[model samples]
Target chain A: MTQALVNGLTLGAVYALVALGYSMVYGILGMINFAHGEIYMLGAFHGILALAFAQHYLANFSPVVCLLGALVLAMLFCGGYGFTLERIAYRPLRHAPVLSPLISAIGMSFLLQNYVMVAQGSGIRGFPMEFGRRLTETRFSAFAGAEFSLLEVFILATSLLCMAGLHLYIYRSKMGKAMRATSQDRRMASLLGVDVDRVISATFIAGSALAAVAGVMVSMYVHAVKFNDGYIMGMKAFTAAVLGGIGNIPGAMLGGVLLGVVENIGIWFLGAGYKDAYSFIVLLLVLIVLPRGILGEQVSDKV
Target chain B: MNITWRGFSGFVFVAALAFAAACGPKGGAGAIRLGVAGPMTGDQAAFGEEVLYGASLAAEEWNERGGVLGKRIKIVKRDDQAKPDQATQAAYELVSEGVAGVIGHFNSGCTIPASEVYHQNNVPMLTPSATNPDITDRKYANIFRVCGRDDDQGRTAAEYAVKTLKVKKVAVLHDRTPYGAGLTDQFKRNIEKSLGAKAIVYYDGFDDKEKFFDPYLQEIKKKDPDLLYFGGIYHQAGPLTVKARELGLRAAVMFGDGVINEQYIESAKEAAEGAYVTFGPDPEKIPAAKGFLEKYRKTYQKPAGAYSIYAYEAANILLASIARAKGTDGKAVSEEIRRSPHESSIGTIRFDGKGDIQGSYYVMWQVRNGKFAALQ
Candidate 1:
């Protein structure tokens, strides 16, 4: 059970990273960024691309350096993509009904998935293990006589660091404050001289960067990257975000980890097929019991 | 408004013409169209692609050989998306397109629904990988399978585990899907029947997206099962094996044919190194399969999966029967298929009254260095 918890935590951390993007976007724009998952998938593809390029051109570089380069490249590319997506798909629908942008986001998701499918034929791309090897080497034979891999440790630590940084940014930074304000009241934030457009765009970029990191981590951990990775991972992250609190940043983190842990436990108690349903059931139960979320502050509109 | 109505009618007429043109003849009077259905997209796309590729190759071969009864064999491919509703739709489309027979609906979930359509349409459908006993038990006159059933596979794996591995205790993990749970049930029954009073722990199927299985592993560890049997596909099996190994569990991991894909190897990495599985008749061992394999590699530049060979054999049988029937008529072809001794890849295939393959053929395989190798 402890091992499952660790596994769930590791998985939850990745989901949390991706969910942060969704939560952040929702916090600022009050819109679910369905394209977040695609952005995450692009991050993984970019990581694979960077790794391939590095192996060919920068052979002298260490695996860690190459991996770091890949991660950065992935984040930058996906961050840019997120910014572009906001400009093209969401900008025009800002004043429109909530369903408009949501549908546009769904369309964008399909477009991205199909684009990748056509560009890269339907073959499962294997992420090279050169970098993964460095991270997941057996550390020590301690718990249940199992040895932890460096990759697993890196995943947990990297997730925590990213979460901590995000927390700091949301609470401590100027743009983060603008984002929080925008989420709270878009018109008020605009009146307070917060660039609502810029803040929303920045939210996408930040969330996308985290998603990109999560994507790379997933590719490394899973070792198989495919076009549809986004759909499944995206759903899970969205679930995590909702489970925590749609607009609560820290709530998303908690929700992600909780969902991951619950899924693993469900798999332990139930079977593999029920895992997806198990997580969804938890989400449903949480929504029924704590509709405002674990940390979300319930708000009401003035009558 | 009149102009627009005329234009719309014209468009509909043109589309109808185009559709007919697409289904137009390649060879003389009697072209046999064999329908192939599987998930060309979604998670199970790889399996579908392999099945389609194998069926296409068979069609090409039959057409090259002066056609079936001097009639060209054409394959009509449809994507089921591994969904029952889609499978039924695809089957309906294929039947309407006047296909002589169908080669699949790969998953049993899809096969069951699609098979009903084929039965209602009086179109003979041979499944390559839909192994649920209920599929054949329905005794649909039009439905048949070229592959071994789960009952055979589960029993064989259990026998190997008990007699060869000599594992005193066993724990079975399955996905809750029909394929997963059904196979697990079969394995449990066989293990218990073979080794009575020998503690056999049966666990329900888990989720594929789970991050950890430590709780289950912990329980299994406590039970001290000598071997672990996973009745699930590669997606979950891969991680389960890896995590189990990581947690210092030394039990040998085993699964059914679902774990036979190349993706499983990539997913499990070192954890799946020594995992065992039961597969259908070995393709490499079959003499007729060598030619097909060479052609498949030459055309696609990749070795086909084991199930693909079954697909090829199924397509071959369908075409052969069509040739013997000498027409695309469904009932006539079904009669021919019922009577015919199929000689193709995987040896001479003969179906019993229930459309199950006559001979009992199943093989045990082990994951050695990330590839399934025939276990001696």
Candidate 2:
């Protein structure tokens, strides 16, 4: 039971990082940003590419330097990609009906997925497992003889740090205040001298960067990378975000961890086959019982 | 108004005529195309990608060896995304592309729908892994399988569990999909037949996406079965083994070919260390498969999966059939496949009257140190 909890929490942390991106964007933009998942995938691909380059050129460097360089590269590339997506796909449709932009987001998601698929052939590529070998050296007793790897610890810590940064940005930073203002009322924010487009783009870039970090962490853990990783992980993160409260920042963190724990416990109790259903069922139940989520403030549309 | 209506009718008639003309056979001197359809995306893409590699390699080898029936063999590939509807569409697309035969629709659910299109279009389809008995039970003349049916694999697994493992009490779990359910049914029946009342507990029809299994696990724990058999893919099997271990169940866990993948080890972690699974012998271990592996690794820069050799053998068989038939005609090629005794990576290959392989060659392996090792 304890091992399951630890495993759940580790996975939940990654999900939470990815979910925060979704929650943050939704909080400010009132849009689902379906392409968020594709950014995560590109992040993984960038990590693999960076590792390859490190192996080829920086062979003399320590493994830690190589991994850190890869992670940074992954974050930058994915962040840039996210910014590009917002500028090219979302920006034009920002003033259009909400449905049009939503559809465009979905289209962009497919386009990015197909782009990766074509570039990376339709095969499961193996990443060098040794990329972060040193980091996984630490082991902690979790439950009933189960040991937690250092990779898991790194994932959890990084996720928490990202979450903290997000919280600070949203609550304390000037641009973050403008984001909240724009989310609360776009026209009013524009009238008050806020650049709504820049805020929205910034929201996407920040979320994309977080997602990229999560993707790199996941690739390190899984040791295999594929184009479709985003689809499943994205769905789970979205579920986590919704579970915590679709637009609630802290709620997403809690929801991600809770969903992970629920899934692990479900697998432990029910058998592994029903893990996905268990998560969805929890989401459905939460949505039905507390539509605004555990920490979200319920909002009523002003007619 | 009358002139506009007359013009519209004339346009419709001309379009119908053009459609008919396009559908008509365009026979020319060119290479015969064989379509290979499978999930080239989504979760099961690994399986499909490997199969395509095997098929493509076979086509290349056949073309190099003086071509098939004085013409080059070409394989047109399609991504089915593992969905039945998409499989059907892919099948039509392949048929329209003028392929003489198809090598797959890898999943039974997808194959079932895609097979109908192949049947309607008179294209022979030889499935590599789809093992549902109903696939061939429909007796579609164009449909056949290179891999053993679920009944064979399930019965073989059960025999190993009851006789070899000396499992006294066993519990069965299935993913509730057609393939999973069918395999579980066969396994349960065979185990009961061999061990009599020893096959005590049977739990079938579990959802693939559900995360929690505590209620079911608690109930299963009470039964205290000596062995557990899971009829599902790696996604579920990996976690199932891990959770079972966590639940303090020391029972030996076994599964069918669906759970055979490196992903299972990663997902299940140490829990997969002792789990056994029955599948077509890993190509890496086969002496005949060595040459193919070297060539595959050189070309694709990766080792082939367990079933890739079988897929390669299947393609070899199809090409040989076309060569023997001396034409790309579906009925003639299928007749050749039925009659010809071919040799390839998986040993002597011959399909029985029902389009099933003649030999019962299933290998059992145990996961050890995050890799599958052949059980002695």
Judge candidate 2 against the unseen true structure and give its global Cα lDDT, from 0 to 1. 0.81
- Which runs of model 1 end up more than 4 angstroms from their true locations? A1-4, A52-60, A120-127, A139-153, A265-274, A298-303, B1-31, B208-215, B218-224, B269-271, B369-371
lDDT of each: 0.82, 0.81
RMSD of each: 3.9, 6.1
What is the C-alpha lDDT profile of model 1 across B225-263, one tens digit per residue? 889998877666776776677556788999988778887
Best by DockQ: 1
Please report how far candidate 1 places residue B81 from its true position, in Å. 2.3
A205 Cα displacement, candidate 2 (Å): 2.3
Tens-digit lDDT track for model 2 on B320-362?
7877887878888888888877887767878777788788767
Top of the candidates by TM-score:
1
Query: Chain A of model 2, TM-score against the native?
Result: 0.96
